[model samples]
Target: MNLARRALLEAGKLLVVLWLVSVLVFLALRLTPGDPAVLLLGPQAGRPDAAETLAQLRIEMGLDQPWIVQYGIWLGAMLTGDFGESARSGVSVTTLIVDALPPTLWLIALAVVISVPVSILAGTWAAYRGRGWFPNMVRFTSTMGVAIPAVWLGLVLIIVFAVNLSWFPSGGYVAPTEDPVGFLRHMVLPVATLSVFLSGILTRFVFAEATDVFRQDYMRTALAMGLPTRRRVFAYAARNAVLPMITIVGVQIGALIGGAVLVEAVFGLGGLGQLLLSSVLNRDYLVVQSAVLLTTVAVLLIGYVADIVYRLVDPRIAR
Candidate 1:
């Protein structure tokens, strides 16, 4: 019953937040300098009939409508699962997003799979090792990972693995349905770049939490109770330490989505991030608004899932 109520409350809150986000995205794009009509009409923008053409274009695009009315219309359409069409291409925003969503989801999933275990193991080892050369090395590498930009890391990976080694494709994507091997080859570098960044962030949190959990009185008692070394560490310390990581894992989805924008630009992948980037650059308001709103909702949904998982992991959260 409590879970059901909580879910209902969260759904309502999400709707309210999404409404506010749509309003902000709509207003921000409109308030930006340079008229979309002028850009769309380009060479003919300076013609004598330009003002009349612009007015007509605005009317066609519903830009001439008051902001509140425009928003109300958009909200109504969105509630019916319509996101309208791209200003430049006239392609449906929903269609564009549907086409591009797969790659970004794959990128994020692959990166998380590679990073999470490595981070947990490395963090656990460092916490257990206490004062050791290996821990120092891990810390140094994590520092570099956190400090390095994803784009720069991507370029370096491309140069080393794609250019020098000639092991993987430098840019461009192949759909897995067409060529699975080629898809994996193309994705390897981008996944590695994102994983390094995510691992760095997760490792630090895991290390801190594991270290603190290790020092708890229960851990000390376990150490003194003749428990097997692996059981004492993994079953007790590691488990408790990992609960904190669930929140970070959820938050990392948003970070990775943002990073995927630059990473996609670097790799030339036709992901949603790339679509969003191009839509924003071209001032495709319907596409931009839909993309940003969807991304925001995805991030929020991931966060809500994380909270639910945390509640499951730590019963105290339910109370």
Candidate 2:
């Protein structure tokens, strides 16, 4: 019952957040300098008929209405699965998002797969090995991970792996459907770029939590009871350490989305981040709004799943 109530509350909160995000996205675009109408009309913007053209464009795009009315119209159409047309391309905004989503999703998935296990093992080893060169190395790596900018790291990797060694493609993504081997080859550099940074952050979280868990009375009791060293450490200490890690993972979801923007730019991947960047630059309001909302929805869904995962990991959380 408590879990159900919590889920209900979370759902309600998510809805409220999404609504607020939509409002903010609308206003942010509208409040920015430069008129979308003027940008749309381009070279004709300074002609004798420019004002008339702008007025017609505003009316056609429903931008002549009050902000509230415009938002209402947008929200209503969005509810019906209409994200509106792209101001720049005349293409459907939804179609653009759909096309760009896959590469970003794949990049994120690869990052998680590589980062989580590597961090957990490295952190656990550092915690158990107790005051040694290995632990110092782990700590140093984590510090550097936090310090280095992802874009700089990405550029360096491209220089070494792609430019110098020719071990992987420099940039640009290949669809897995087109050629599986080529897809993996293309993904290697970007995925590794994302994983290294995320793993560095995750390592610190895991090490801290595992160290704390190792100090707890339950872990001490397990040790005293002569439970096999590995079993006791993992089954008891590691399981407890996971609760905090779940929260870290949830937070990382947002970071991954943001990081993907830079990573995509570096690698020339045609993902949602790239699309969002271009749309925002072009002042394509519909595409920008749709992309941001879609990304936010993805973040919220990950958070909701994290909540459920927390309950599963420790049933006491459900209470």
Candidate 3:
């Protein structure tokens, strides 16, 4: 039950989970309906020679070969920093991802920053304030947040903030390079959209965790020692409560990336979410598969980081 062995075993298991997810995602995208070549090149419009173009596309994507061979080639190329070309744009999938990843990362980073601490604090407060009308109200709101769809929320924000108030851009990205102020203005809506959704879930977990910690023997001992409510609750209960909340948030990271597709499309923000949607629409298997794998890797990485930090906070976690 020592920490080191547990950590190693957990890490290995998480890696296996990630690998399985990647494989399935890759296969699923390829199995979807529609031909990427036709999606990209169109049906005998410019070519006026459907058969010849399809043969060329089959060769380019190795679709002319068996599934296993194609998978090997695709996976091999992927590992070597070669993402292959998009069927539609003839653009390298890796290049497109590089171009698109930053905005999505930035958006997620901002949302996380807002969600985590706020959730922890609010949850702690509610736990300490227990059974009060205010705490009950907060709990109800958190439940709603967990229930409501992020996409629906995004649309609501767009209508209220962008359309009704005559404030913020309803959709689209503004590159910081091209227009810094415009970029920020465009950022506010989507960031708020994501933050609201995340904060709700985090807050609920935090509240539950904090409440559990509040009942622990250590909290009673701290109070018996004449520690102030704030000090005892925060330094004792809050500290212990954070671990589970952290774990949940880490798990949610991957799912949020998937969730962002809807949010980004609703907001018209150009990020991996939007990119994933477009790739799906075009039936661009490589791009879609790559994006899903990338997102899954991110989730695993974050969860692993949380596990590492868990050991630091709760040294007994290893046992």
Number of clashing residue pairs, candidate 3: 0
- Candidate 2, overall lDDT? 0.89
Q: Count the backbone clashes (under 3 Å) in each candidate.
A: 0, 0, 0
Local distance difference test, each candidate: 0.90, 0.89, 0.82
| lDDT (10s digit) by residue, model 3, range 188-291 | 98888788778888999889888888888888888788999878878888888887666788888876787777778888778998999998898888888788
The sequence of per-residue lDDT tens digits that candidate 1 reaches over residues 108-177 is 9999999999988898889988888988988888888888999999999999999999999999888899
lDDT (0-100) at residue 64 of candidate 1?
92
Assess candidate 1 and give its TM-score to the true structure: 0.95
Task: In model 2, state the lDDT of residue 225.
Answer: 85
TM-score of each: 0.95, 0.95, 0.93
Rank candidates by lDDT, best first.
1, 2, 3
Which residue pairs does candidate 2 place in steric collision?
A: none
